[model samples]
Target: MNITRRALLAGTAALPLVASAQTASGVGRRTMNHVKDHITRLVDQHRDGVAPIVSLGDPVLRQPADPFDGQVDDKLLAEFIELMQRTMRAAPGVGLAAPQIGVPVRIAVLEDPATVSDEVAEARHRYPLEFFAAINPDYRPNGHKRRGFYEGCLSMPGYTGVVNRPYSVHATYTDPTGHPHHKTFTGWQARIVQHETDHLRGTVYVDKLEPRSLSTTENYLDNWNDPIPTRAAQALRFHLD
Candidate 1:
């Protein structure tokens, strides 16, 4: 999530794993410095202690996370759920994976208020998301439709690229309470699910994007009306369906 696969593909595959959840790799340092500052500001304003995001290039982000067995007490899972939810909200991102916080467990949390103008809401099919947690989740595309848009990551703070994804998906998982659950998702909801699930599988959005379309947030905003690059489809020789 933090470091795009292309960065590694470009010759930095040797990035090390984070020693601790709070530690970021050399690549993460620059972006995380800003994240830390943002956290500090949040602390100063609201006193929330948010967990730091694990940077890209960490081995954990590249390795499949461990699935949780119901062996642990409900108390612990409840606490972990709260912590992950708080961390996700604190990071202020729509989703957070266990590996992003250096926990190698197959758990993730997601919520989105779609706090934007009508254009964004219409474009993303955004909806107000209530707090939800997924344990050992999995999903499959409907194969009926596909979507692409500028995707960003908390781990990969400053950069964004357009990623094509299924417009709808069906997924299944267990809740922290050991309850089994299954559901279908579409639009932005589906995208969020895919993004977090990818983290659990050691796959990042960067792995699916056009390498030439990658750009810093600032650059992306400056160069394109939307995050999608103008010549990206032609240059990349791919069409969004």
Candidate 2:
């Protein structure tokens, strides 16, 4: 799922200001530096035109997004969606939300082509999702069955945490062209949808994680990628139903 970050208006000037706010919000110096470098890279990559993805601790991410009003052929909305797609691809993430790029609009994009090994795919019950965008999305758990899996976000670069979510979800939303859509997603696709939907409602994966299970990407790859530790669920007090 694409994680949303930052609260400032878009542009170079807004970055430093957001960085300072992140610092004041008690994010460590190391984390702040990491975020700055991250923001710089995003800006450099999208220098052509894409908007930058915000980093965590920006108050904007905590605010609920505005609903898309179905403005078909809206030039600015079209540009925003294009830039978000480009940004998600550059981040190499499976999904992204407008809140991730400093716009608090209820719009998101997600896609996955079963890019991992069969082992990993089976572990997560993964499947392919053709590219799609949702506006003003609303969703709910489809069943009591839940699955826990490692989750990451483009906005929260270099971290992965385990979050348990329902194995299936039902959702309804409008497409950019004002067409409405409703579907039930299972497995990894459900996870992706829930993650993006969380952003629209002003939440992130961290909020649902067993906090101690959260780790940097490097550390997770080095130490935790194998069989999940037995006490992880107990420690996080998470119940896998």
C-alpha lDDT score of every prediction, in listed order:
0.69, 0.69
Q: RMSD (Cα, Å) of candidate 1?
A: 10.4
- The lDDT of model 2 is 0.69
TM-score of 2: 0.76
Q: Using Cα atoms with residue i matched to residue i, what is each candidate's TM-score against the true structure?
A: 0.76, 0.76
Off by over 4 Å in 2: 2-49, 70-73, 227-241
Q: Local error of candidate 1 at 209, Å?
A: 1.0
Per-residue alpha-carbon lDDT of candidate 2 for residues 16-117, written as tens digits (9 for 90 to 100): 124466557754454434434444444456656767678778776788876654322355456556777777766667788877887666889887766666
In every candidate, how many clashes are there?
A: 3, 0
- Per-residue error for 14 in candidate 2, Å, reads 29
